[model samples]
Each structure stands twice: as C-alpha cells, then as structure tokens.
Target: MVIYGVALLAFCMLVGIILGELLGRLIGIEANIGGIGIAMLLLIFLSNYLKKSFNLGEITERGIHFWSAIYIPIVVAMAAKQNVMGALDGGFIALLAGGIAVFLSFLLIPLLSKLGNK
Candidate 1:
C-alpha cells in the first residue's frame, strides 16, 4: 500500500538524518548536511529494488512518486530559509564557492545535453 511507501520514506529519512548528523560531526561542521540528499538517494535505490525484486504494486509506486515530486519543493524552501547573510559574513570564500558552483553547473549543461543525445 501507499501508506507502506510513506513509512519506508520516513524510515529512510530518519536514517539519513542520523547519518548526516554523524557525518557533519565527523567533519567538524556541526550541522545536518546532506540529510535530504542521502534520504532521496536511499529512497530511489531501495524503492527500485523493492519494485523489481518484490513486485511492489502501482499504488505504492504512485505514493513514492508523489513524495519524490514533493521532495524538491521542500528542499528549495529549506534552502531559501538558510542564512545567506551568515555565509556572506564568513568571507569572500563563500561567494567564490557559490560562483564556482554556478559556473560548473552551467558547464554541465552542454555535457549533459551531449550525453542525452547519445
């Protein structure tokens, strides 16, 4: 059932949050870094495995798909809530990092387009 899929997502989210916290602590960051990313990746892999190996029904698939669709909006909202001022206060390094990331993402466009054509 779709409820089962929700439970599965929640479980993955919990584990991802724990793991993210641990990783942050290990790296001396003291923040929950990459938790949602980890959870989404986990959900992708495990849901595929369950669908292929266990023949999960359409309802569960739809439920998982719904959550996946909802995931990005939530992430965007959370990211928007982040302390951009604090990052700027850290120094020019943060701005540099952001610029580099934007440049790299723009660079990826042509590469991804070529790959898609292949």
Candidate 2:
C-alpha cells in the first residue's frame, strides 16, 4: 500500500535525526548534524531498494515520489535560511569561509565535468 512509502520515509527520518544528534554530540556541538540530508539519502536508497527487490507497487512508488518532490525542497529551503542566519551570527570569518566554499565548489564544477567525460 501507499502507506508503506510513508512508513519508510518516517523510518529514514527517524534514523537520520538520531544519527545526526549523535554526530553533533560526538563533535561537541549542540545541533543536529546533516540530519535532513541523511534522511533524504536514506529515503532515496531505501525507496529504490524496495522498488527493485520487493516490487513495491505503483501506488507506493507514486506516493514516495510525490512526497519527496514536495517535501525536500521545502525542508532544504528552511534549512538554508537557518544556515545563513547562523553563519551571519558567527561573524565575518564565517561569511568568508562560506564565500570561499562557494567559490571552490564553482571551480570544481568544470573539473568534475571533465572527469565525467573521461
């Protein structure tokens, strides 16, 4: 049933949040670390596994695809705003680091593209 898809997503989210919390604590931080990203990855992996191995029906597939399409962007947008606020609060060094990271990522795109071609 389509409900299974929801259950799988909830399970992934739970695992991700718990892992993120543990990781944050391990690193001496008081926040969840990469929880949402972990959850998204889990959902993607698990959903594909289910589809391939168990023959998860059309209904379940559609449900998972629909919610993922709708939910992830909203969650990511919220997280991005929080990150920006936190970075701003952290000071100029945080901003400089973010800017450098962005610049490096942009520089990597062409190199990555070339790697894909070869």
Candidate 3:
C-alpha cells in the first residue's frame, strides 16, 4: 500500500534521528549528525530491497516516488536551519574556507562528469 511506503519513510526517519542523536552525543556534539542522510539512505536501501525481494504495487512505488521527488526541497529546508550568518561572522577564515571548498567542488565537477561517463 502507498501508506506502507509512508510508514516506512517515517520509520526510517525516526531511526535515523535516534542514531544521529546517539552519534552526536558520542562525539560530544549537540546536533543531529547526518540524520537526514541516514534516513535517505535507509529509504533507498529498504525500497530497493523490498522491490527486489517482494512484489510492490504501483501505488506503493508512486508513494515512494512522491516523497523522493520532494526529498531535495526537504533537505534544503532542513539545511537552511543552520546559522550561515553566524558562520560568516565567525571570521574571514570561515568565508575563505567556504569559498575555497566551493571552488574546489566546482573544479571537480568536470572530472566527476568524466568519471561518470566511463
């Protein structure tokens, strides 16, 4: 059922949040570390495993797809909660490091694309 897919997503999200909290505590950080990433990975793996191991209906697939389609926006919204202005105010070093990281990431795009082509 489509609802089952949603239920699965909810389960993954809860587990991810718990794991992330645990990880953050373990590392002495007061944040949910990689919670969303973990949830997304869980969704992907579980969905794929279910698809292969059992026969999922079209409605269930559609439900998964629906959430997947909005996943980016959800992630963006979650990330937007971070204090970017505070980071910027921290120091020029933060700005410079961010700029360099962005530049390096941009520079890697071509190489990454070439690798993808192969």
Evaluation by TM-score, superior candidate among 1 and 3: 3
Sort by TM-score, best first: what order? 3, 2, 1
For model 2 the TM-score comes to 0.62
Measured with C-alpha atoms, the lDDT of residue 70 in candidate 1 is 93
Cα lDDT tens digits, model 1, 1-118, are: 9987678879999989999999999999989999989988998899778877897777877776897799899999999999988988978898899889999999999998999596
- RMSD to the true structure for each prediction, in A, is 4.8, 4.3, 4.1
lDDT of 3 at 86: 96
Question: What's the TM for model 1?
Answer: 0.60
The positional error of residue 83 in candidate 2, measured at the CA in angstroms, is: 12
Please estimate how well model 3 matches the true structure, expressed as its whole-model Cα lDDT: 0.87
- The superposed Cα distance between candidate 3 and the true structure at residue 17, in angstroms, equals 1.4
Scored by TM-score, the top model is: 3
What 10-residue stretch in candidate 1 is worst by lDDT? 55-64
* Model 2, span 8-70: residue lDDT tens: 778899999999999999999999999989998988888677767888787877767788688
Candidate 3 collision pairs = none
Global lDDT of each model? 0.87, 0.85, 0.87
Candidate 3 off by > 4 Å: 71-100, 108-118
